[model samples]
Target: MTTETPVKTSNWNVPNALTTLRIVMVPFFGYALLHDGGDSIGWRITAYVLFALAMVTDKIDGDLARKHNLVTDFGKIADPIADKAITGMAFIGLSIVGSQSGEAWYVAGGEIWWWVTILVLVREWSVTLLRLSIMKDVVIPAAQLGKIKTTAQGVALGLLSLPLVADDNAWGDTGRVIFYVSQVILAVAVGLTLWSGYEFFRDAFRQKRAARA
Candidate 1:
């Protein structure tokens, strides 16, 4: 009887390592944001730097995975988790700080409008669950609009993370402008997010119907 060769796996490769690094950075990023109640400019800067580094790792890891054929089940699962953790933390932290400080235009009556967070979370978690449910029979790849949404979210969060917007410094006006622009970008991201969620559900339904037929 001829022996069968074992299939090689690259789960422990550089791409996955970077993805793990991104996951590791999430707490540090949150700490920097929450340190001293997010009042210290130094802490905010540190948070922004950590966030940027984590975002960079996101890109590098995906590129490396695709380029070197290092993509694995672990990477596929962990990569999105890392992305959501970093970004979700950023959004929650920003909303909390905005509500407390009354500085963020997005906040009103000392409340950061729970609707925004609720909408985003609902879409994200629902789609993720739907994907998992159909994963055995269908593979739903990331769409172009989804990538745009991610980038917009990242840029908006990065802009909001900076201390300039909340400080009464020379750059305060600039910071305000950036903050407004970031809000616009965030709105676009939210729209795309909802649209993509609809598309995902639509496609899943169509596929299920087709398989039944």
Candidate 2:
């Protein structure tokens, strides 16, 4: 009888490479944000562009993995870490920069609050830990609401990241208008973040109970 050789699979594939690239981009994105203290319009624009490119990689990597059956443990783990690092930096950086500026108002004629960032961080980290706790027992796939929350956060952060208008400039009025709209979107994202967190916990606990039964 002729012997058949088993197909060998490697973990280092296009999807994982892209995910690692995204992680590599995080420092560059942060540098672009902090290099000029986020005051220079050019640097701020560069940061936004880098962030957008990183976000694109997030989508492309996952799609490539699914299409090519190249998904791996490393990709699954690194992907979310990259996402949280990028998005978390965006929110924190925006809030810090806006706090420093005298004219960074949100929808309610107030500065972007740190509590918003804190709340989002708490939810994100808490859910992440929760997942790790149940990783072996249950697979908690991302829900549809989670996707919407990510999109909303991405758009809102993108708008907020741009340094298009100054308070005294002619474009200030337009920029304020856009800022208000972005804040509304951010609010929706925050709402979804909390809602999805609740769903995750609820499902996780229910699953645990069922498993114990």
Candidate 3:
């Protein structure tokens, strides 16, 4: 008699599955945000709720993968793709809407600035290309500043969503204050994101030099 080994099922990978869910939700979230009349606060609120849930899944998948040793290349690649899809779309859509409304320059414009959004997109896309060029074996772990940038982004986006809670008093002067604060936070976040990208490049260069030596 021979003992048979149980085959590990790929379906059992929770982290990769969660990341895939996030990717799938990105288009749907974008549609909801862009399709809605932009007048109803409910639509924005719904979009925000979906965005928040996606973010929660990000945290969960990372924690679970780390704790259970279930990390995989699929998870690594899909996670960032999901992030870019969601954030890039949100940043662009908000800015477009704000600009079209002709209130982008106003203090309560509710629009994301094009320059700020472009900066984020450039960083995300550049790093993504760099990672692909270098291959998966060359791991560039998230810097401390990167984590701070993520935190700041989450806070700012959340505050922006707050204005969608009601119609009349949904986001009065208080919400404007929060919006302004978030703008500052987002500006800082962008600065940190660039700094973190530079750090990654510097570390990568040093490693290459050492390898050549």
Candidate 4:
């Protein structure tokens, strides 16, 4: 019997291009979010749009890659980097905006606490690094909690990116309601981040032990 060879897909593809676009967007998204110290309603709106675009593109690229067999090593590497870069910018930019906006504003469940940002970022980056580094030796399946955490984070950050607390917000009471909702979601996201991270670490250790045995 003849052995079948695996097909190698090239790096240049639509999904990879979208991933590249996401990487390119992080800085622009940050600029928009931080425009006029994150106080400009117009800029905030722009930032939200850019963020939404990135999120949508991320979903699209992953689907396209999986459906069409366009997955590549570059796509794998760049996709997560792009995802983290943009979201990390959102977390950092919103914290800055909240701080700059004084007591009336902040995206940390109402002026996102810097500690929240710091802790979440640490967990996110550490988990990502560990996953990539040990990918070959230990294959740990993603937990559903991790997916939930990501979705919650995306929704929270998207809502928080808006000038939710601004006096000039056209959304007015509606904006306040959305802000409250986003705050609740962010709190949940933070909880999930910690919980999921713990699960990931625990599973990783288990997997490593099994691999050695």
What tens digits encode model 1's per-residue C-alpha lDDT throughout 1-213? 999896767688999999999999988998988776677788888999999998999999999888988888888778888888898888787777766675545432111345787788788878877777787787778888788888988887887787755444635566667667877788888888899889888888888888888
The order of the candidates by lDDT, greatest first, is: 4, 2, 1, 3
Residues 15-61, candidate 2: write the lDDT tens digits.
Answer: 88888888888888777776555676677778889889888888999
Q: How well does model 3 score by local distance difference test?
A: 0.72
- Point to the candidate with the largest lDDT: 4
Error of 4 at 92 (Å): 0.3
After superposition, the stretches of candidate 2 with alpha carbons farther than 4 Å from their true spots are 1-9, 102-104, 107-111, 167-172
lDDT of 4 by residue, 1-213 (tens): 999899899999999999999999999999999988877888888999999999999999999999999989898778878988998999999888778767644332235778899999999999888988887788777689988888999999998888776866567778889999998999999999999999999999898998899
> Which candidate number has the best TM-score?
4
lDDT of 1 at 99: 64
Preferred candidate (lDDT higher): 1 or 4: 4
Candidate 3 clashing pairs, residues 3+ apart or interchain? none
Better of 2 and 4 by lDDT: 4
Give the worst 10-residue stretch by lDDT in candidate 4: 102-111
Residue pairs with backbone atoms closer than 3 Å in model 2 (clashes): none
Q: Assess candidate 2 and give its lDDT.
A: 0.79
The 10-residue segment with the lowest total lDDT in model 1: 104-113
Worst 10 residues of 2 by lDDT: 102-111
